[model samples]
Target chain A: MDLTLDRIRLAYPDGDGVLVAVDDVTLTVPSGTTTALLGPSGAGKSSLLAVAGAPLDAPDDAAGAPRAARGPRRRARRAADRAAALRRERIGIVFQQPQLVASLTVLEQLELMSHLRGRPAASRRAHALALLDAVGVADRADRRPEHLSGGQRQRVAIARALMNDPQVLLVDEPTSALDHERGVQVVELVVRLARELDAAALLVTHDEATLDPVAARVHLADGRLVEAPAAV
Target chain B: MFLALRDLRHARGRFALMITVVALITFLVAFLAALTAGLGRASTSAVTELPVDRLAFAPPAEGASPTFTESEVTPHQQEAWADVPGVGAAEPLGVATVRASGESTAAVTAFGVRPGSGLVPGTGDGGADVSAGTVVLSRGAADALGADVGDQVGAGPLDLTVAAVADAEADFAHTPVVWVSLDDWQAVGARGDAAAGDAQDGPTATVVALRFGDDPPTADALAATDAELGTVTATPREARSAISSFTAENLSLTLMQVFLLAISALVVGAFFTVWTIQRAGDVAVLRALGASTRYLLRDAIGQAGVVLGVGVGLGTALAAGAGLLAARVMPVVVDVSTTLVPAVVLVALGGLGAVLAVTRVARVDPHAALAAR
Candidate 1:
């Protein structure tokens, strides 16, 4: 497995105590494969994605599950360092909304990812252009987010997420805002891009119809992953 | 500043509005500072221009403080000051406000110094003499009375000839000054008319100007001298408040300037506060994308600095141009202290306000961006 979440747990404040968002959730996906997390809203699917992407720090202990023991402060610092490294080296994200900055053009948006990674943007222009071409929005490189349609904007965002050639792609509801046909196309694009780029893709989706193209599907209910269907 | 520059380009109208506010505030601050400096110069130039380092006036009586209008240094007090140890020179200076007439009548403060005192105007190397029965007027006094060199002007009972106009400006009590011999000032002060007092018991001169070399007298020495001679001594700069008009005029103008500066800071703070709050969502998204808190802060402050710089630059330029034009008709100075200093202050203060406002970026949670997950 290229990306793994080893029995991760996450919690948020509820009243006085903490409420579990993801409980003992262990998952793994190999390179060049796509996995779809299917669940209704508030089923801890996004929490699972967040943990896998290292956006949320996993809980310190897993309720007596065998784990490495360390001081709380040391563990927290390690987790923080891991998250930072994950963001810089391994992970890419597609937010549910287009989440495009209003001022940046489509090409500039992708270029910014390279800039943030401390690469000279001019040096990475060809790579950025190629990624945009792969996402089928190379012709609209100069257009601002407002000028692009919803589907085109989503494509631009996907291209942006892959700009750094990340090893793991965490997408949040990429097709939620698209029509049925457009939604299917977006899912297929995610699967194809995952294969072409040799990246492990985690697609979180509420629409079950869009899960057919993904190689593996894991359903989530109330912060717990349901068992995968047995092979026939 | 990638996002900063792009945001400016995208929201030119809002940034332009902010810049205009900054520019106008800077202009007002610079103008007020110039006017304050100009007015202060007009009020205290006479004492400040005195060659001596200190002035000694008669200490006020019970329940009163020392004042140029009320305090007087007698001949005995001047002699005592001159004889004090470490004192270099002590010259009696009689200051009194009186009306002078050439082509027109105007209020003037006549400064009385002895012959060869060098404190008198036009007494330096190769300078023309201002003996008894003759006076030297400052440029302001000359302008006010419309008098020229060799013109005879009536100063109270003494009809004196204006021997020469002094190049140095000296004003007291918000009135232009005329330099005359001590005898002439006494003659003017003793004029038997209602404007001049006939009381012989009063002190001869208003104050004694003092100069000291090595081992200047300590405060205790000065206090002992004050007790013995019945006089009060002060540095020339400190003596400015003794002028009645200077205190009131400077206080009002300085207060207004301070208030304006405070308002400028508050205005910048308020504007940036709203701007930061409006961009909180963007800040959250950026943070979630691994943008450090420091990066976001730099971007926001850079945005603010750009607005402040352009705005303050424009406003300062406008003020300097207007000040130059106004110098001919009004008392306005357009120098670096008057122009550049205020612009720098505006940018610094406005930047401070911006920093305060945009610190909210540090507290924005990257978790909020996860809501879309």
Candidate 2:
């Protein structure tokens, strides 16, 4: 397994005490595979994916299963800076919305990933172009987000997530705004990209119809994972 | 500044409006600064540009600053100052405004200096001949009276010949100057005491010009001399306040410039504050994408710096052109102090406002981008 979660727990401040968002959920997704977390609203599917992406710091001594200790490099990078470097170097996140920067073009969106890691974006132009080509949005590469359709923007976002060739891809509802057919197409596209890039993908979605292309499925409810009888 | 440049290009209209506001403020500040300096020169050039390092004025009332208007230094006071150690040359300078009738009549300040005092610009170099009954006219005074060298001018009960026109120009109380002998100034009945031509103990001139030869008197020694002579002394710069018009005019103009500077800073701050708040969602997305807080702040401030540089550069150029044109009809100086100094100050203050506004980037949570919009 390229990505592992050992009883990951996450909580947020409620009115007085704490409201646990994810509790004692241990899961692993091997490389070149996609795992779909299927649950309804408030099921903590997004929270688990967020933890795997390392956006929210995993609580120490969480559920008597403390997170893996940081190595020398991670220890030296300092809290937020460390997380940011982790995301920039190893984890790729796809938000619920396309969330394309209004000022950037489709091609520049991929180029920005390289820029964030303190590399000259121009140095990776060929790779960025190849990613866009792989995602089948090469024709719309020069267009701005407003000029692209909803499905096209999602594809461009997928291409951007793979720009740095991250090891773990965490996608949250890639087709939330799409219709049935487009939703299936986007999920299939994510599976293909994850396999081709040989990256472990954890996708959070409540749409059961889109799970056919996903390699495995897990059920979550009220911040805890349920044992699915037919673990497909 | 990659994102910054793109954003600026994408939102040209908003940034253009901000740049215009900054430019207009810079124009107003630079122009006012030039006018203030010019007006100051017109009001006190004659006194400030004197050849001596210091001027001794009759002491004012208790707890009051010295004034050239009310000061009256007598011959006895002048003699006392001349006898002081390190006193190189103490010359009596009488300042009085009178009407001069030459080819035309104009109000002129008669500066009374003894022969070979070199208090006038053209005296030592033979550019002007300052004998009895002959006056040396500053270029401004010559132009005002339409009198050239060897021309005769009637200066308040004294018929004086313009022996030579001085190379430089000086003004006092906004009137052109004409150098006259000490006797001629006394003959005009503009002395402190009104004796109507009878021999009387009266003020020789308004102030005495004091020049240090090799070793100037120490501050303590000068203070002691002031106490002994019942007088007060000031450097040429400090004496500028003694001119009644200069003090009021300069203070008002300087205050206006200061206010404009403050307004520019607030305007820049307000503009960037609104811009930052409006784009907070974008900032969150960027953070989630792994952009450091330091990177975003640099991009924002670099954008502001580019705008300020262009706007202030254009505004300063406009002021210089306008000042050149305005100088033809009025007093307006266009120089480095008036233009470049104000521009640098505007950029600094405006940059500070931008820094304050963009610091909010650090507080944006990257997790917010994970939620559904």
- Against the true structure, whose lDDT is highest? 2
- Alpha-carbon interface RMSD for all candidates, in angstroms: 4.4, 4.2
Best by DockQ: 2
> Residue B2 in model 1: shift from native, Å?
1.2
lDDT of each: 0.81, 0.86
Cα RMSD, model 2: 4.7
The candidate maximizing TM-score is 2
Q: Kindly list the per-residue Cα lDDT of model 1 for residues B1-373, writing each as its tens digit.
A: 8889988999899988888888898888888878877778788888988888789987887866578887777677888899999899999888888989998999999988787888866678657656899998999999999999989999988899998888877788779999888878877752222125555444668899999979788889988988888788888899988888888988998788778778878888899899888888877667666665566778899988888889899989988888888778766668898899888877788888889998877666555666733
Model 2: per-residue Cα lDDT over B1-373, one tens digit each: 8788889988999989888889999999999989998898888999889988889998887898888777888889998899999989899888888899899999999988888898989566666657799998998999999999888999887899888888886998899999998888887635546225553667878898999979889999999999999989899888999988888899999999999999999999899999999899888888788887678888889999988998899899999899999998888889999999999999999999988888777666677788721
Q: Which 10 residues in a row give candidate 1 chain B its minimum summed lDDT?
A: B189-198
Regions of candidate 1 where Cα sits further than 4 Å from its true position: A16-18, A57-85, A228-232, B62-65, B190-202, B218-220
Candidate 2 wrong stretches, greater than 4 Å: A57-78, A229-232, B199-201
Candidate 1 lDDT over residue span A44-86, tens digit each: 8878877776755434242233545436535554564456556
lDDT tens digits, residues A9-32, model 2?
Answer: 888877899999999999989999
Model 1 interface DockQ: 0.30
Backbone clash pairs in model 2 (N, Cα, C under 3 Å; residues 3+ apart or in different chains), count: 0
